[model samples]
Target chain A: MKSLRTFIPIIILLVAWEAAARSGLWSRIVFPSLVNIGREFFLFIVQADAWEQIWTSLYRAFGGFALAAVVGVLLGMLMGRSQLVAGLFDPLFSGTYAVPKLALFPIFIFVFGIGSLSKVALIFLECLYPMVIMTYHGARSVNRVLVWSAENMGATRGEILRRVVIPATTPYIFAAFRVAVPVAMIVVVITEMISSADGLGYLVIYSLSSLRTDRMLAMVVVIALIGYALDKLVVLARDRLIYWEKLDTYYV
Target chain B: MPHAQRLAGAGLLLVILVAWQLAALRGLPSYLLGPLEIARHFAAALGSQELYEHAVASLLRALPGFALGTLLGITLGLAAGIARSFDELLSPLVFLTYPVPKIVMLPVFMLWFGIGDLSKILIIALACFYPTFINAYYGARATPRILVWSARNMGAGEALIFRRVVLPAALPLIFAGLRVSLALSFIVMFATEMINARSGLGHLIREAENGLRFDLMYVSLVSIAILGYAGDRLLRFSRRYFLPWEESHA
Candidate 1:
């Protein structure tokens, strides 16, 4: 019941949208009816090309996200454990952290080509900073007491890392994942919208150009659902794997 | 030790650049310009008035959106955090839609606002809002309850308590949010320009790409990189000045 109350604003917005669509204040092209948008959305789901576009986007996003996760965690862990490594890489990461990596997408297209590879590479680069930074914080702050206790028990370094460090840093990893997933989606969509002939972003641009506002809104809906679903999937996986800590926010 | 480490980092960068330069010396592809060549082209571009015009266009779009978004986001987010009524009305919407990329609304914005800098600026503002709002919300909410109670006991009014206690405590997180939003504003600005624009660095790069002007492309890339890096440094310097007591993350 409480959760249902949280959706009241969204419902109200939807009603206002329907009213606006029907009020004759604007052209049908400007404000497509909700029913028309719903129908287009339904039709979109059944279409093979729509599914392919979604798949293409998902493939790039997940591919880049997965790659960033692996490399970022490793680099972060290394930096956290070794002052030398930290000194070398810390400035490099933080100095460039606020720079929009998307600015390099053009160069990436040249370097990696206009295919999925370039998009994935940009996504990976964009997602890497958050994952690395968050994991570094988490790994560096792992309680020294735990490490000491493990060592006093004659545990090997490998065992200490496995039993204490990884578990302690899991929450931060998930936090980083929460941050990176949206980034992955953003990079993929931006890249597709900028250059690609495929994917949901391209479909949005295509639909708009063709003066099918309803269809474009439908595509936006599809993209939003994918983003929301991906976020929920991350939350679900985090809850299952790192069940000890619940995420405070929807994504974080 | 610090000197050695700095030298090592610089050396690593130099090695990579030198390797690329040597590869270019052997005749690389049309697309891949050497670092030195890129630097030279960037300098040449900087000498021209066109680069300045494009840079100003990009900056105008990004900075105004960033300022507007951060201002609104910090205000609304702080209000929602403190006031139950506002929280009930606003936070649900913000949190629920947080994951959706704001860029997806660019088309709708273009339709509503017209296909000009207005739409692009608004879209960038929308993108910048989420991080600042979320961070500021959490920042304000996370303020120690004891401090608020003590302030109340001292006969401080609501406004006084908020201005003196809550805002100060929340400023760090607000700064964090602003940093994120600044980065996002640039990104959204670039993306909007790339998707549709007659001006800005994104358009310059695209034009260069289509024309096969490798030097122009490299110049644009280097220009953007320098702009991004310089913006970040300026933010850090301001943060240091404003929050002198706060131990910033390196």
Candidate 2:
């Protein structure tokens, strides 16, 4: 019953949308009926081409995300642990944090070619910032007492890092992951939308140009579901691994 | 050793640039220009009025949308976070759709708002809205409960408590959200312009690419980097000024 209360607004919105669609006030193109959209959405799931496009987008997003995860964590940890590294790389990352790396896509196209490579590269650049910055903070602020205790107990440097620093920074790593995953999705979609013949984003643009509003909406739904599911998957993983803490809120 | 390390970093950058320059010197491709040549072209373009006009156009779309979105997000999110009734009415919607790429609504927005700056601005605003709202909500919710209770016990009214206790506590996270929104505003603006636009840095880059003006492409890219960096610095400055007690998070 409590859960139902939370869904009231969503239900009302759907009802309003259906009513508006059925009223004949706007063209079907402007607001496709929910039934038509649902059918198209179902068809989209069953279609091989749609699956391929979805896979293409997923691959690009994950490719970049994985690369960022590896490189960002390493760089972040180095910066956090070494003052010299921090002084050098900190300025670079924080300085350009606000700059939209998307502006380099044209150059990337010229260098990496107008294909999945360019899109993934851009995604990697975009996702790297939050991951690195968040992880740097996490690693840098690991409790000094924990490290001292581990050393006092005759733990080696590697042992201290593996047992203490890693555990301490896990929450922040997960936080960065949450931020980077959505960023990966956004970058992939943006790049594909900007220039691509395949991927879900390209499919969206293609559907729109063909005046297939229902299909476009269905694709949008699919994109949203993918994004939401990826986020849930991250949360599930974090919950299982870092069971000591619960994610009480969404934003880091 | 510190000086040596600094030199090593700078040397690495210099080596990369020299290698690229050397590669271009050997006639790499029509699309690829040397760093020196690109820098020269960017300098030349800076003297022209076209770049300024495009930069202004891009800024007009991004800044206004960023401001509007952050303003609305902070206001609504703070209210919702503080008031249970508002939270019940709005938070579910926000949280459920939080992961959904707000950019997908660009088409629908374009249909409703027309294929002009309005739609672009609104879409950017919509994108910016999520981070700001989420951050502001969390910030307000995370306000020290002890502080609020003490204020209440001291006979502070609700409005006073909110203004004196909640807003200041929430300001840091709100600023963090603003930074994200600012970056997002630029990305969305660039995307919309790239996909379709008469003028802007994104449009400039696309035109330059299509016209085979590699210099212009680099010029637009550098201009965007400067704009983004400057905007971030400005935000950080304001954050420091307003929330002097809080340490820099970004």
Candidate 3:
């Protein structure tokens, strides 16, 4: 009964979509039938060009995310542990937090070139904010009692950080990663769509321009699946690594 | 001491700007303008109608989309939080699509709604929906059970309990969601405009990029920065006003 309830809305949506497609109220271009979209999706998955586009987008997203995770965590940890560092960098992040970093894309293109480099860099910058902010919060809020206990046990700074601080911050880091991974995907796709010769985003544009709405919808599905899977992957990793902390938030 | 620290912070930024200007004096790419030059350009543009027009266009697209998306998100999210059937029916779908970038639908939107303000507005609305929905949902769900019980015991009806208890409790998180979606609305608005638009800061920047008008590019960038910062401040202020009992903290 519980499982059935979960699928009910999805079933209704699909049925409604199919009905809309068959109702002939609009052109097929506007509402491609599920069967057509499914066929196109199948065709796309089997195509080498589609695989290449997927790989291009995936690598760009992953490259940027990996870079952000490393830098953001290190900087966040530094800021968390040191008041001076926090004082110095906190304003920099928060003040510019509202600014759309996408505004800098044109400059990035000139500096990094109109290739995967620019896309990856933009993704890195975009993903960096959430990671650093979340990790900083987590690291800063590690219980004072835990630190005091660790010190009382004659633990070194390194030992205390490794045994106590890192563990406490792990959950927050994962939380940041969860927020960031999707952002990375979003940036990659947006950048690619804005300027790129190849990638899933580019393919979507390409299909749309060619008036292949069905194929375009198929690409959308592929992009959505990749996004959904990446999110689920992060949740799985978080659960495995931070087993002690159950992610009860709807965010996951 | 706190004032001194803030000055120190500004000092660092000032130093970076100075260094950048010095570097430009030596030699830098044409695409890269010094801070002073950029500021001068921004000032010049401020005197012109072009900047205002584009900024207004951008705001028109961003604000309406934001209002619509947040309104729907808050209503549905709160409903789902209060009712079990709605929760089961809607939440899974929302969560599943939560991570999917809604920008991919822009082309489809353009196809369906025409390549006009409607498409841009709808895309922005779609992008703004997720954060607000999730935040509002969590905010309502996290309402204190004890408070609800007390209200019930006091003979308060369901509507009364919701209005007095749930709404207030959810306001903070709802504000957080609004803050996030406000940022997102600008982003999606900028992106859609950049991708394809006749006017707006994004379009202006794109034009500058293609025309190699570094001054115009910087002007547009500064305009967007100012707009975004101002909108954020406005939201923060409103949040404080609405939730007076909740302490203002970043």
Candidate 4:
């Protein structure tokens, strides 16, 4: 019953959209019919060129997200465990936390060239923050009672970290993943839209420029579906790996 | 004790800058400006009117969008949290679309709102809306039931309890949402300008890149960094001012 209630708004939105599309008071460019959009989406899915663009975007987003996951976990763990490290790096991260890293894209283009390399690097930088911050909070909040009990049983440093610290921090790592995945998609599309020869972002721009509003909307749908799918993948992995914990947050 | 730690932090930053300057002396790419050179260019730009024009243009878009989005987000989110019917009606849609990249709406917004500042501002507002709504929703729902009961026992009316009990409890998280939204506003504003605009810092950097004016590029970079950092500081200051009873950690 609750699940059915949730679908009401979505259904109403779609019906309204279809009605507006059929109204004809507005240009098709502004309100492309759902049927045309569905057809364009089908074409987009079947085309080899479209798949290549999707692959390019997926690889860039994945490459950056994977790198951030590894490095951010390590750095965040260190910062959480060591006060000295925290003092040194906390200000650095939190200080520039609100600054738009997109401002550095031009410089990155000059340094890393106008290709996947620069885009991947920027994505890596952006994803790194949430990962590090969340993981740091997670690791720092691990129960001292657990650590003391483990030490009393003669567990070594490595064992304590592996058994106690990591298990406790797993939930937060997943939270960070939830935040970073969409960010990876956002950065990839934004970078491609700003300046790129290939990727879904570039395709959206290309379609818009050539006055194919249907194709552009189709690309938008594809991008949104990919973003949603990536988020689901993260949740699935988190659920499988951390079966002991419930997904308590509304987002992840 | 804290003072010494702060000094140590400053010392570390100084070390990084000096090291960068040293590396540049050995010769780096022309595209990369050393710390001293960036400072010089920033100072020169500060003396000119051009930087202010671009900065103001960027702010005009970011501020209005941030204000509008957060205001609506907080109001609707609180309403949904406090009222079950509203929650069932609104939250499902918000959560379903939460993971989708909001920036993809830019082109469509351009088509509907026209190819002007209106589209860009609206896009930024749309992007800014999500975080604030989520945070405020959680904040309102997380309020302790005991407190609400106590307020009611004291004969406080519905509006009184809501204003007194709900608002204070939610302020911290709401501020957190605003911080995230403010940062997002700058990012979306920069992106829209970069994708299509005649003016703003993003456009200035694009022109500099095309012209190969390395100094101007660094100047724009420095200006943006300063703006972002300053905006964050201002937000933190206001948070402290408003929530004096709450202790801030990091």
Highest TM-score model number: 3
Interface RMSD of each: 2.3, 2.7, 2.0, 2.1
C-alpha lDDT (0 to 100) for residue B134 of candidate 4: 90
Worst 10-residue lDDT window for candidate 4 chain A reads A243-252
Which run of 10 residues does model 1 chain B get worst, by summed lDDT? B1-10
Instruction: Tell me which of candidates 2 and 4 scores higher on lDDT.
Output: 4
**If the candidates were sorted by their DockQ against the true structure, best first, what order would they fall in?**
3, 4, 1, 2
lDDT per model, in order? 0.88, 0.89, 0.90, 0.90
Give per-residue CA lDDT, model 4, range A1-252, as digits (tens). Answer: 989989999999999989999999898988999899999999889988888889999999999999999999999999888877777777888888888999999999988999899999999999999889988988899999999999999999999999999999989889999999999999999999999989999999999998889899999999999998988888889888998776455332
How do the residues A58-159 of candidate 1 rate in per-residue lDDT, one tens digit apiece?
Answer: 999999999999999999998888777877787788767877788778778888989999999999999999989988888999999999999999999999
lDDT of 2 by residue, B121-234 (tens): 999999999888888899899999999999999999999999999999999889889888999999999999999899999999999989988888889988998898899889
TM-score of chain B of 4: 0.97
Estimate, for each residue in B26-71, the C-alpha lDDT of model 1 and write its tens digit: 9998788888888888888888999999999999999999989989
Q: Per-candidate DockQ versus the true complex? A: 0.57, 0.55, 0.65, 0.64
In terms of lDDT, the poorest run of 10 residues in model 4 chain B is B1-10
What does candidate 3's lDDT look like per residue over B1-250, in tens digits? 2776677678788888899999989889888898889988989999999899999999999999999999989999998888988898889999988989899999999999999999999989988888888888999999999999999999999999999999999888899889889888999999999999999999999999999998999999999999999999999999889999988865
**lDDT at residue B69 of model 4 (Cα atoms):** 92
